[model samples]
Target: MAVAYDLEGQKRAYKRWAPYYDRVYHKLLADAHAKTARAAAKAGPDILEIGVGTGLVLPWYPEGTRVIGVDLSFHMLERARDKMLSGAAPQTRLVAAMDACRLGLADESFDAVAVPFVITLVPDPEGALDEAMRVLKPGGAIVISSKLGYDTGAMAKIEEWVAPLMKKVGWSSAFRIERIKAWAEARGDVELTEIAPLFPAGWFKLMRLVKRS
Candidate 1:
């Protein structure tokens, strides 16, 4: 399996992908984006979206919502900034270039943290999740939409085989859901509130974790 995490590689990959990211993923991930937005909105008004590439989920957030987005790729944020400036997603107050594993944000600040199709792409997913949980307020939630790999099966084998190739493009194909589950269990500060499979035969998933007060 591909376990190496190259920050520079990710940056380079996304820089190349930013220009046409929406054209490639907008429709494919529309449902998941909408669902993620709704889940975050339901949690509360103060929302932070991690790896908010191209701001595809921005317009989906309800009117009057406070949305802040962050990504490691300046190129991707440029596109997202353009979308924000177009007034397509007026709810978005800010979009900045920030590292997922080292967010320059306050602790226990946001009511909800949304990570869409980003966990597996993160260089250090556990560290990123730690940051997400740190920024999340008690009683708030961390919502995620991602393509999770199988833990054991022929599909898992295939994912392992393809992981290295996928890494060059900016994400891991063998990132398992069990890793997230283990993170939640280890934290003991959050609980699994929801885990629903998304399109393309359950390859994608929408998961939520509520922080305990």
Candidate 2:
């Protein structure tokens, strides 16, 4: 089994990835980012994006959307700050260094929460989702884009085999969709509203969970 992921190691990995994040991920995740941002925007104007590295999706939100983004890595937040200053991401209102699992924001303050490509990277994915739910307004949505692991197939075995190696780099391909489903099922206040596959052969997917009104 792979060692449990820690926040420190994850921060360190993002620090190294900070400078090149947008360059490396911008085009590759463009569709996912755009779709996620648009979905969040549909919820309302106020959005909180957890693990908002480099603010790549900030620019994709509808104009007038007020987005407050947080990340654990200062280096990553710094680049995101630059995007705000450069006018590339006008929807961004603030970018702070904060842990996703323990958000320092007011409860029920946001209309939606967007977490793109971050669920598998966090040390506690369910904890992060809990925080997202804690801050989301009733009837609001939590939008997530992630690479989900297969349950029982050849692909499942492959993800399991490479999980340790992937964990070392910062994310786990062994993270399963059932885990998120279980979390939602455990919380009766939340509902799985939508799930759709992204590009690159459905390895990545977008999920939306809505809080009960």
Candidate 3:
């Protein structure tokens, strides 16, 4: 369990999780990742994927779509790079270590951006969203898949009880999709959609937002 929200904490948690993350998380997130990737692939070729954990969605992207993947954890990025070199992720043009909130890329550098299961993990999700907006080209799209807390439900009560424990294990149980929606809407130059969860459990959501700049 991690005790902090700093980069070092992310590295610690991810380094420990890297070895078994695919087995535990891949199956659970497969449907969500696949659905988001399918929609994003149609956006354009040049794509930047933040928090590209283990490159799980790598194989799903279209062949011609070029992708640059960045993650805060080196151990995780190593896994992503391996997938690329092994031909399991031919669309992955590059996999490198970087912070999502401050990627030093040029403005309008990408045709699209993908942020899968990352908002809750990062310390500053709003800053990360702003960065995504900064790097994306006009008319570019952003796809995010996240599991957010329910406001009213027996499960919601359970989540509230276990959130602290989950955080120690490395994620918040209460990250909100509304924050992302509001941010985009506030810009007054974006299109946002709340897609139905691809998985039947309905714990996750796919947010598709397009910059109209």
Candidate 4:
């Protein structure tokens, strides 16, 4: 197995790409926002968003929703702040330097949690999901949108091959959808639902899970 990507290296890579990340992945990001917003609508009230890079999903958030965004990179958070000032939903709150594996929040504090294209980036995905589940109230939902474990024939193979190189430069791993689903379901209280498609012709996956009471 390849060694885990270093967090500091990942941070620097993101900072370097902050100027171009959105431009290169705008379409995929937009689709994820739409999907996340729709899922959030189904599960509402106190909401938490992990890896809220550049606050791309802010616009789609339901009006009056109590949304809190957490990101690991300060530079990315700064860009998110800029987006918030320019166009993000006014109600969204941004928090900097929050680690996914150890979220500093009370137990069952949120009605729903969202992780958009973020899990694959963490070396300890299970730990991060556990933290997500810990902060969500019983029956609260966790929505994750990613391209993990996806199989789209040649394109999928190409993406897998390119993933490591991208990581070496600062991009997160391209995960398989099945692995993500399995990991989520491994926790007894979590139930997976509504796996959906996004853009790039079979390149993205959106998954919703509800934590059992």
* TM-score quality measure for candidate 3: 0.87
* Candidate 4 ranges with C-alpha deviation above 4 Å: 1-5, 150-174
Candidate numbers, best TM-score first, in rank order: 2, 1, 3, 4
lDDT of 1 by residue, 53-105 (tens): 89999999998689999998899999999989999999999999899888999
Model 2 earns a TM-score of 0.89
lDDT of 4 by residue, 65-147 (tens): 77888988888788778877775577576556788888989999888899988888788888888999999998888898876
Tens-place lDDT digits, model 2, residues 65-111: 99999999999988889989999999899999898888999999999
After superposition, the stretches of candidate 2 with alpha carbons farther than 4 Å from their true spots are 1-5, 152-172
**Preferred candidate (lDDT higher): 1 or 2:** 1
For model 4 the TM-score comes to 0.84
Candidate 1: residue 23 lDDT (0-100): 94
**Superior candidate under TM-score, 1 versus 3:** 1
- Cand. 1 Cα-lDDT: 0.89
lDDT of every model, 2 decimals:
0.89, 0.89, 0.83, 0.78
Which residue pairs show backbone clashes in model 4?
A: 148-175, 148-176, 148-177, 149-175, 149-176, 149-177
Better lDDT candidate (2, 3): 2
- What is the per-residue lDDT of model 3 for residues 1-213, given as tens digits with 9 covering 90 to 100? 433357888699999999999998888788988987877876789999999988999988887899999999999988999999999998888998889988988999998899988887788787888899899999899898887765667867877887888678555656765677678778887789556665736667788888886
**RMSD values, in order shown:** 3.5, 3.3, 3.8, 3.7
